[model samples]
Target chain A: MARLKIESLRKSFAATTAVDDFSLDVGDGELVCLLGPSGSGKSTILRMIGGFEQPTSGMIRIDGQDVTRLSPERRPTGMVFQSHALWSHMNVFNNIAFGLKLRSLSRGEIQRKVDQALELVGLAGYGHRQTFQLSGGQQQRVALARSLVLEPKILLLDEPFASLDQHLRERLREEVRDIQQRLGITTLFVTHGQDEALAMADRIVVLRNGQCEQVDAPDVLYRNPQTEFVAGFIGQMNFLSANVEGGRFRHPDFTLDVEVQDGPAVLALRPEALRLEPSDSPDAAGVTRATDFGSHIMVDVELRDGARLKVMTAPDARWQKGQTVRLAASAFALYRQNRLLARGGLPVETVEGRSRHALA
Target chain B: MIRSYSSTSGRFDWMGLAFAILLVIVIAVPLLVVFTWAFTEVWRYPSVIPQKFGLRFWDQTLSRADVWEALFISLRLSATVTALSALICLPAAYAFARMKFPGRDLFFLSFLASHAFPKFGLLVAIAAIFLQLNLIATFWGVVLIQLVGTLMLMIWIPVAAFQAVDRRMEEAARDVGAGPLRVFWSITLPQAGPTIFAAVLLTFVSTFYETEGAWLIGAPQIRTMPVLMINFINNQVVVQYGAVLSVILWVPSFIALIFARRVIGTGSFAKGFGA
Candidate 1:
């Protein structure tokens, strides 16, 4: 295994930059995911590291050796492309053994390694089958086996499961993760699916507009996003525009104590972090809609000031539509100009008394 | 049920029958006349068929030394011209198909322009240049002139073939430790093999039958079969000699057509041109 370090890497096509000043450090045997939507430069970064694309600036070092100027064949990196580009002229065995044959390995050795790689991808006796004879999922397995047989120091996957069905994508991602952990090869996976990144990557790098938005572990990224884009992109977040003065967040319906300057701020709260209770006070919000998700009910509440919020609560008849419900946030993040300023919990104050709702 | 299906499907097709008759009158009648003349000892005007049928002329023409020399020269020139065209044009076709250099489209258009005009006029101009360069009446002169005809077939068809090769497959080969040359051999060439083979066969057959260039450049010394056939038609009194030469010249192209059918079925041949 090798540790890959990319320092200030940048790529530009004639008039536009695809990736800009992107730097990443992946430890030995760690699978780091570059997660973003389309045109986010995630795939460009992976291609630069795989030597398929030359960076306009900066350096790529693998195990303390500079490899920025190396061609794809000279680099110790193998990539599984998005289209599973197996050669149609070759059968499964030849497709996987092509690189080994180029290295001039003996026939017996190449056969043994190809068989072993096929078995590792769960296709033990499919060597003689033609590549076109395989299904979409099976073709991807052959593509994976083709790259893995080279025994490269680094493995790169560019949305390899983007063409498969939902179940197949899930099963293949799990299998790929299992094989990567078993082989302990340093891998960089590029995906637009957040769930895939969360399930397969040791750490996720969220990118936006050719720049790094946030990089953190899965649960940490979901629970504590550092920016408003990350907060909204990672999960379902309710954003409310409010004003802050004298350390008090002044919403149209209610107010809360905050630790920011005297200016307008944005509050981002996750659906499950807010609590709902039936009430008749002027500060209460009317239930617009409610959906029961078997384990919990997702209630959409619209405040009197025309602001809407989604609150997740247990199965309660009082959380239905037309019910005036008082809202309380167990946790919230305050943002100014799309940057997170502070995060805290708020207590719900009712006619009876002030009570803090602790959510699991 | 099978009998009824056949009867309905095979109902009399007058259009197809008319086309078949037209084809026979246009193509088969001349061939029938040639074959009959090659075997006839005597045939005269005002008669539908030959008065006497024999192989006397065939025996006489087969014994001629010029016939054998012309056949050998035709085969040798076709082979050399085909090989040289492939050597020079395949790489240029690939560069035109895949590379992004300045004036590439203009260069490609120029290759297409080789076939745009009356070829005899062009050959006369080229002959003037060949005469000045001491290339007149030389074997290499005929080869050079024949190479011009092969350009359109050699460059255009294979350019389309190479353009149709999936670039992702080449990148996959490179990603798996194959260098640029290795990727081309393993992936790109094999995918484009059938179409390129079809182009080579076309170049060979066309060069074999090429008359103007061989007649103008290799006269009096290096005579190909088509050049000899033209000479026999112009100078010889007997008709059987030209008939035998025509029959002999049709053999290579007929065989080449059969081979072309197998290499690229009619569908893909059309697709190669479509691109």
Candidate 2:
């Protein structure tokens, strides 16, 4: 049985719908990420699960118990806020011990639990330090420890690393994932950052306009996004308008044979899926604007018709500015409007032999 | 270079020094005169200073049965008013700071409007209402009137203080299994400590110095220190006794100001509300 099940949850504030028809089931010990840009209702879903918000029309079941109308304090979920929300007046030890104390645990048990939580978050001896005296990363750990000490039925983190610097954020992302896995706690993490979601989550739920756009594993979300929005959002993609007639796909600069239905479609090409080679043909002429980032190079090509295509290549690859280059895709996803048509590695003959033959 | 330029300019600010000294003296001279008269045995208008100084007036005022009775009544009334206003305002302030209800801004503006209205103008109408309610000359009557007059400060200060408390802190507490009241006591109240302390001090001192409501609402049957002080001033022969009463009233307020100085100096209160 699913540890937590949310069915058709909707929340409307005044005339605006903040979260609409949201539904998901979190399995036992699964860490799911709600990923979206700002104002996408991901945080709203987390708040609803945490019982901070009341869904307009839906039911939430945790461990087979209805919890939709329950107040936050009555629920069995723990949440770490984006601000880390450490009690400024309380020391780290007291902040971590707060939930245990509320549960009316024995003094000795509370102490043991708090100490274990501190160790789990790697802040074992810093319990007595004032929360404000700690650095941003330490404060975030205290927030995590505070929630984890409760041994709640579920853990909800609302962009917990948003306040930290990039370096600290990356480190804590791994630490939190490790801790969550060790405890095997059912967890829901909310973040607008795609990298954070991809790095930490076992599954990603993409939200847009108060609804779930797609829910899949990180690799699946990146490789085979079912929608154009998901394709663009999860990773970088170059969208090119093309037409398929009798299994031949034709674009302004290139043509190839593909097993696609005869119609107009948009091809979503990942930058890494394409390559650039110097060309003398006027039709294949393009200028190279390459940006080197040590590990890889991102080359942006401006075609003669004013279309910009990006291609990612190895750091050793060299291309001069204003050089004419032909573009070829090793793989791409085809979409008709917002609907997906085909996706995968292109046939070698279709990419090289057919393109060269068509150009000649 | 800028530091040297500022330092060089700072040396010739004689006019600024003069204005500060004048400001202090202007404020201190009245209290000094009141203190001097409270202990003066004999003085004439043309003397410019007292010819004789003793504690005769102070002793006479302290020995009076009515004077001590008035002092006790005044202390009790102010204390009750301060407590009652806090009980009413703390929740109202929290609501104004944290919750969004219909007409919230209008409700808050009403408090500001009540504070802006001159207290003296409302005294007569308030007295009439108290008289009809059979609350005239009652201790509770004076307490009620003082609560109304001083509630604006009690509420406004804490509203800002509570707003300064991050909303996420309260939510964190709730997520940690704390109920609403527990979250308030453990998080909200402690975060708002300095402001609440300042509010109590302001409310207590204001109520302690209130004369209009005390005199108008609790005159003969309930004689507060201010009412007695007014009585002493009304009598030409015993006019100096008013100075003794003024010193008596000033003592608690002075102590409160000293305490407030420490709290406000912590710099938390100076950040202002909604900061």
Candidate 3:
């Protein structure tokens, strides 16, 4: 059982700190993805775990052993790089056999293990093919075989799918996930692409500016981002700046009783959660000319006071440019904080649980 | 068919052909003349063709101690110098090419600075230093001085060669559980083999034919080939000059030249020197 616990890890490159007070735990058989943009320290944390880099301050314990100061070869871990660093001079078989050779395994044993690895990556009978002669996808398999042949306790992957084409990326992602599950290895994967992280990882650790913005299972992180950064980074978030006072939330020209702050607050509304209707009571308004973009229709509605509210309608709807309409977002209960980004006991009481009577 | 014919149609220029022929002749004629004269019995001046061709130069030159000793010393000294220089510079070259450390560029620039002085200007001082060290007539002195002087060229060539091996390859090897030494041996050194071979060959050839370094600081007991040739020519012995050069020199140089094409390359040299 390779249970990894990283405690307050920090890494600095001279004056530039790449990872700051980062901490996480990966239970046995968990596949965790460190998701972030470039320079977000996602890759750096993976490197530190892989033993390729030393954290400025942290404790890395694997199955209760501190392996932070160990070299990569000494640590019970295997890593695949972004470029699929296969040995060009060696054939597929020999490349994968390198680790076995280092371990002083018998030639027969090495051959058996190598063949098993090759077939595992679906490159059976390709043992003699040189790495350069293989296609990009095949070369990626060779790289995978090279690492899987060792079957280390923890597997670290650093953007391995970034170079693969879209079709191959999809296929290989499934293959990798299947293989990881089959081996039951604890894994740490790093990627800047959210879709890849969402598709492959059991849990996603969203990072920004050398700090952990949030760490939760994919659905939780996506649905309940505790901070604005997490909400914005995960996918599309339609932002509306408003104020909360007198136990009520105030949108421009509208107000409703809600349990929230008494000062400035930003509401991140997903476009799909917004609703539209004809303004029979004259409170709702939407647009006409800015309609019908792709499968959805984007309408801009102007209030009598000239404040504009935008809403997306289905493509089948017949909303045109000159029409004025009613617009209202879903209830306040529809949105939630992204807890991965929550800083403290920054007290987040649920909307229904609190005594605010209506919505915020 | 129309597209194929159009693609096949081309232009020709006679002036370009004539100029190319002229350039080839201008380059090839001198080398041809040298080889032809070395093979013929035409030791006298002003002869378009030899009146006779014989093994007279080879047979006579084989008996001369000075010629044999000089050629042997030149070959041995060059081999020793080249080997020593490569051994000393290999690690330094790898560092300069791939590693990042404090003041690397400044330290590398210091190695190149020794070549700033003209060889002619340093003849007297080199001679003095050799005398002080009692290396003025020692074979080790020739090898030592030649090694230091040739190191810049040798190190720079391999440095550029190693730099061309792509740092990503090294990083890959390291990621795959290879240590620093293993990375160099398996990745960097293999990639740089051809270029390093060429560098060593060039250094050996240059040191073998070096006239100034041998004359200024070499021991009379360990005479280099060029010094031997010059002394033979200065002795007013036409037959001896022919014998010493043709038999004692041309064969080995000709053999080396035949294999020189292996070391020299065209576009692929970009990977050697690193664009």
Q: Pick the candidate with the highest lDDT.
A: 1
Off-target runs (Cα >4 Å) in candidate 3 are A242-258, A275-328, A331-360, B1-10, B13-26, B43-65, B98-103, B164-180, B230-269
Query: Candidate 2 vs candidate 3: which has greater lDDT?
Result: 2
Off by over 4 Å in 1: A238-257, A262-266, A269-331, A347-360, B1-63, B116-118, B231-244, B265-271
True contacts kept of each: 0.88, 0.95, 0.24
Q: Which stretches of candidate 2 lie over 4 Å from their true place?
A: A242-250, A256-264, A280-288, A347-360, B1-22, B29-57, B95-113, B230-244, B264-275
| Weakest lDDT window of 10 consecutive positions for candidate 3 chain B | B1-10
In candidate 1 chain B, what residue range of length 10 has the lowest lDDT sum? Answer: B1-10
Model 3's alpha-carbon lDDT is: 0.75
How do the residues A279-333 of candidate 2 rate in per-residue lDDT, one tens digit apiece?
Answer: 7765565665889999999999886557788889899999888887777777778
Provide the TM-score for each candidate, comma-separated.
Answer: 0.83, 0.88, 0.83
Worst 10 residues of 2 chain A by lDDT: A348-357
Root-mean-square deviation of candidate 1: 5.0
Whose TM-score is greatest here? 2
| TM-score sort, best first | 2, 1, 3
